[model samples]
Target: MTVSVLLFIILAIGAAGYALGVRRARAAAGGDTRKLHSLTGYHGQSVLLFSAVPALVLLGLWLVLQPLYLDHRAGAMIAVADIPEGGSLDLVLADVRRVAEGLDLLVASGGMTEDDLAAMGAADSDLKARLGGVGVALAGEVGEGVFEAARDYRHATHGLSLAMAAATIAAALAGLVFALRRIGTDYRARNVSEGFVLLLFIASSLVAVLTTVGIVASLLIESIHFFRLYPARDFLFSLTWNPQFRGGSDLGIWPLLWGTLYVSFVALLFAVPVGLLSAIYLSEYASRRLRALAKPAIEVLAGIPTIVYGLFALVTVGPFLRDWFAQPLGLGSGSSSVMTAGLVMGIMLIPFVSSLSDDIINAVPQSLRDGSYGLGATQSETVRQVILPAALPGIVGAVLLAASRAIGETMIVVMGAGAAAKLDLNPFEAMTTITVKIVSQLTGDTEFASPETLVAFALGMALFVFTLGLNIVALYVVRKYREQYE
Candidate 1:
């Protein structure tokens, strides 16, 4: 049976068990609620939890591990000679899975039978054409070993699926029987049910921690693979960024790193003062009506998609800057330049800084402003001295958060700044960032084992580390200054 059908059956059984447990508890208590250790509802909940939770856990484990076991067995069946040149075992395994699925579809459609599939030979039959008729396309002709492996894979999968369903249902029934027998007047059903709930809450909290660990682990492993193929010093300190798929390549990171920091610095240089001043005006000086109208208007910039921002950078901002500033100053001739991307990215970052700063400024205690006013300080003086210092930590955090956002931006950099990686001092010269290079390196037909493809992971790891450093600095600044204010 299918997993969904089995889940439905298990839930139905749990429902029946709940009703039976409640009835049994009332009978044991002589239909007197005062005699029971816990409420009748707790007894029912206990029965439901026992009947469903174990079975669901088992089903989840089976679903996760079954495919891994099947894949290993199928991979073992394919000989090394069967894997084509310029291909790995993973590619062959993909073909085996596709062919196996196609065979199942053919059998279901009455185009083939189990006996026919068993008797089929790759030497005599056009396997690709037969599978294609059933809507499964292969990259190349299937070998005899792959065909046999696929057949065995399908059979093993079918057998395991049946076994999983039976075992899950049996577990549900066992739990139901055990809980029903334990449903007495003296049973501590409430404690047991609440324990399960506590465990569930703990598991939910660990999910975020586990997810972060998984991301770091994956990036670290792939980066290690990349570093083994290429020198770490060259990847880190070399002055150029170029990748050759054939043999020799110059995969330096400095040009990309310089472009990323230069763009982000330009963006922050524009965004911080404007956004912070806007926040100050809205929070401390503007009337309530103006605050309501202006805050949402500013925040609307954040809602527009990044791709839309990229297009705006491409069509409007890039050309306007080229014609008005870059050409007039003779800094550069190109429409796509670092200044173009930085200005457009600064526009995009305005909402992030303004909204966050406004909220943080407003969060400051009113008493500080009142005291400053009582000391005969003007509103502007009070803001500059007392309010600004108090909100400095949060403002720093907001700026760094915006910086992280700017560093990770790809579409704007690609559209506004051209994808030329170089270490130049001119903001008007087109350059690329680490994110752009990561995408370029991974695009098109490339081998995962090659340095070009693997470098994407290394770049990603570097970005992650840089962003993590920003967050750590933000945290330290907040913690160190926040105590004095509090």
Candidate 2:
């Protein structure tokens, strides 16, 4: 069976088990809410874990090992003499699997035949007919080399699939029996099931933590590779930041750092005033009807995908600025520049800053405001002197989040910020960020062993560290402020 089919079947089994367990547990408890050992929902959840955990663990193991085993088998079968230039064994294997996946779909659809190669395109029919028509009319079942690899891979995969299925079935039976056996007089099924529920919660939380660790691990490994080629001094100082993949070139820190700071400063210029003032107005000034209508409308900016913002920066803002500001005033470049990305990114971050600050502002205790009012302070004075002071740390925390958001933004920089890695004060001049270049280095055709490819990793590590530090500081500040207010 295909992976999708197997996953669907597993999910269905888990859902059914959960539903049945809830029904049985509820019935067994004589419909007396107080007499039950656990809630019906907890019983359902317990059954889900029983049906899913083992199967998923097996599936994860299979996915990890399958590629290594396939590489081994493929290497053994295809001689070194048969491999082509500019082609890797992995690429060849990927091609083989794609064809195998196509064949599997054909088999599942019961559509296979040999047909004419030249005339097959003339047919108009359903997918099944088209597939069979192409098979019969265009070519043989598959090329000999591809066919060999596909058959071997399929045989091995099918064996594993059968074993996984058998294990899952046996485990499901055992788990059901075990759970029902424990359903007895004075049994604390609630405690037992809640333990499992908590395990599930930890499992979900671990996914986030593990993903972060994986990214950092990737960055660490990549940075090591990069540092091997470029010396620590060159990476840290020496002024210039032009990077090329060919020979040993001077790779310095100054230019990129300058460009990053310049862009960020411009973004902060736009975001801080607009976001903070909007937050103040929303929290302190807006009527209920105005708040209800305006808040979501303003937040609609956040719902727009980043790619769409990139497009707007490139097509609309870039041209307008080039024509109006650069050409007429002779300020900077005639194309994409740092200001374009900064301005667009700031627009994207406005809702982030405003929404968060609004919450923090609202959370400042009413007693503080009442005290200020009792002291004969005006609304503006109370907000500026008393409420804002109380919430300052949290607001700083919100601003820190916005700053990180600006730094990590990619599509806007790639599309609208100039790719030039030069040190310049002119916002109109095109500039590049570490993220924009990281995307460029990683995408398209790449040589994984080269420093050019590896530089992405080093840059990624730098980005991760910078963002992580920002987050930690923000969290700490927000927590400290909350404690003070409480």
Candidate 3:
């Protein structure tokens, strides 16, 4: 029984249990719903929750742990001599998994039978040819040790899967029986159902919190390893950003940080004014029909992928700026420049700002505007004094969100802004960001043990810290403004 099949069986059992619970509860109450301690739906939901949750939890744990157990068992069979020169345990284990999967596919697809697989050995059978018949390609010929390990892996996997299916089904059935037995006229099904719902909400929140903790812990560990190999002072303070995989590299944060801030500043400068003005007009002056039609059309820009914007910057905006503005103004004439990426990124962020700001502006009470007008104030004066101040906190939040979006963008910087990391005041000069450098450092054939590869995690940690500070500042500004209004 596969995981999917097992899940389906559990679901079918849960559904049947729900129906039975509802019917049994009504029967116990002599078909009088009001005589029951809880609603029919609550009884049904309680049974469903009891039947599904424990079984699903068991299934999830088994699936997660089964792979680790199998890998450990298989890895034990491979001696140091089994690994080829210039190869590590990870590489051998990868091949072991691949071969194991291929053999499973071969057996399932009827390309090989039980008797044939049992009799098969590296000396007796063409393992690669058999796998290929089932569309599983190996990089090289299967060695004797790897072939034996894969067979063990397949056997362990099959046994564990069968055991998992049986255990999960039994758990679900047991839960179903227990819940049905408790479905009496006096049972507190409503309270039980609400408790289950509360547990679900708590589980969802824990998943998000745990995910953040995992990211921070991973980054911190890898960054510590990175700092051990490379001096933290050079990485943090040095002005240069040269990462040589061959050693003696100056892996500094300044150039990348400078470029990130400069590009984001330019983008915010372009987006905030235009987006806020557009929001003001839409909220304060536009007709309902026009606002409805125009808002979605403007928000359509948000749906246009960042990659598409990158291409737009690369082909159209980059050249246009270089030919007209940069060259004519005696600035740098590179087609790929910070200005190219910044302008395209600003266009991409317009919808985020406009939509959020428009909603915030509209949320300002109509009574405030009316009072401002009654005080002999002009429409513009009313907007400036009453509506703008009221919407200031939300507007700040929107701008900060857009700024975060700009700072984290990679594709536009890659395509429009060139990959040269430098600190320059000239917008026409090509530069790169931390995200782009993070990507560059991690890619290619760079060894993970090297400081060059580890620097990616350090860069990531810095980016995380910067974004956290930015959010803190945004919250402070918003709170200050909100207090004044209150």
Model number with the top TM-score: 1
Put down candidate 2 lDDT per residue, 200-263, tens digits, no spaces. Answer: 7999999999998898887898799889977867777777766666666666656766777778
Query: Which regions of candidate 2 deviate over 4 angstroms?
Result: 3-52, 76-78, 85-87, 95-150, 178-183, 241-253, 472-483
Q: Give the candidate order by descending TM-score.
A: 1, 3, 2
Given candidate 2, what's the lDDT at residue 26? 69
With a 3 Å backbone cut-off (N, CA, C), the pairs that clash in candidate 2 are 114-136, 115-136, 115-137, 116-137, 117-137, 117-138
* Candidate 3 residue runs with Cα over 4 Å from true position: 32-34, 123-125, 137-141, 287-290, 483-486
lDDT of 3 by residue, 385-412 (tens): 8899999999999999999999999999
User: Given candidate 2, what's the lDDT at residue 216?
Assistant: 80
Residue 285 displacement (Å), model 2: 3.0
- Per-candidate TM-score against the hidden true structure: 0.96, 0.80, 0.93
Which of the predicted structures, 1 or 2, would earn the higher lDDT when compared with the native? Answer: 1
- What is the Å distance of residue 121 in model 3 from its true position? 2.9
Q: What lDDT tens digits, residue by residue, belong to model 1 across residues 52-98?
A: 99999999999999999999999999998899987889999999999
Error of 3 at 243 (Å): 2.4
